[model samples]
Target: MAYKKLSEQVQELSNPQRSDLFVKQFREAVREGKFDATFLTERFTMPKTFSRRGAEGTYQRDTRDMLFDVTPDFEAWFEETNEALAQTRRTGNVKPTAENIAAGLVDFKALAEETRRKMQASYEKGQALGKGRSRTSSGGGASKTRSRKK
Candidate 1:
């Protein structure tokens, strides 16, 4: 299926109402056994043009663009980084740096592949369970059942 533009998707995620709607739609699709790896990749992958500038004027987009969600690993890293920054501000013990954050950030490529595999497996299982259409014919080329009298 055709997905929305990357910019538009980012904008939607940034908006509270739009993000909630998107999440709801995504959940419904998954629950209905309609989601797959292709859908996940298309919806979550970031475009190449996106990037962020650091405090020291260095541009870093390659890594940041890889993240599709705020995973637990990234959250832990963020908390650590925040504490480090706070410590630096209070005691001037160490310099604040983005390196720690970068190091702790999720590897989007690996995450994406894992997600795709898991979702694909679930989709196949659903199809096998008759939640989705089967590839093989149920019988032959024509209907076998007779019409009932009214």
Candidate 2:
């Protein structure tokens, strides 16, 4: 049987959204000796690119060392990252705060409704304004009188 990498196993066990759960479970397995870290050298890649920066790279020299380190609390990390990302998506803010959301500063639903109402009103106004316009040409529904058959 072919050996599967830790990431491949994780992918099989869970999707992207639940990847953290797999990592947590893997760490717990490591902590309990259910899986030996040293044996995982061939099964897992070492020093993810983001963690490969300078001093941080020293701490994660191998998959075993990386796995042995304390597992992070992903829930808080996810929450903070999500909040930061939402703030980044908002425009024209020197610094976005919770108040910006609470104060209803960016109400997309309300803005969309207002735009729809304006568009409808404009369309109706155009229809009313166009009522006065006349069609100079008519369809070819009426044929010219045919000459009497010889």
Q: Could you tell me the TM-score of candidate 2? A: 0.25
- Model 2, 48-92: lDDT tens digits are 233454554433222432323222443344354434433543356
In model 2, the runs with Cα more than 4 Å from the true position are 39-150
lDDT of each: 0.43, 0.48
Question: Against the true structure, whose lDDT is highest?
Answer: 2
Residue 126, model 2, lDDT: 88
Global lDDT for candidate 2?
A: 0.48
lDDT of 1 by residue, 16-118 (tens): 2233334444445435644331232233432223335553433213111112333454335434433443344233433224563356555556666888999
Candidate 2, 18: how far from true, in Å? 0.8
lDDT value, residue 53 of candidate 1: 59
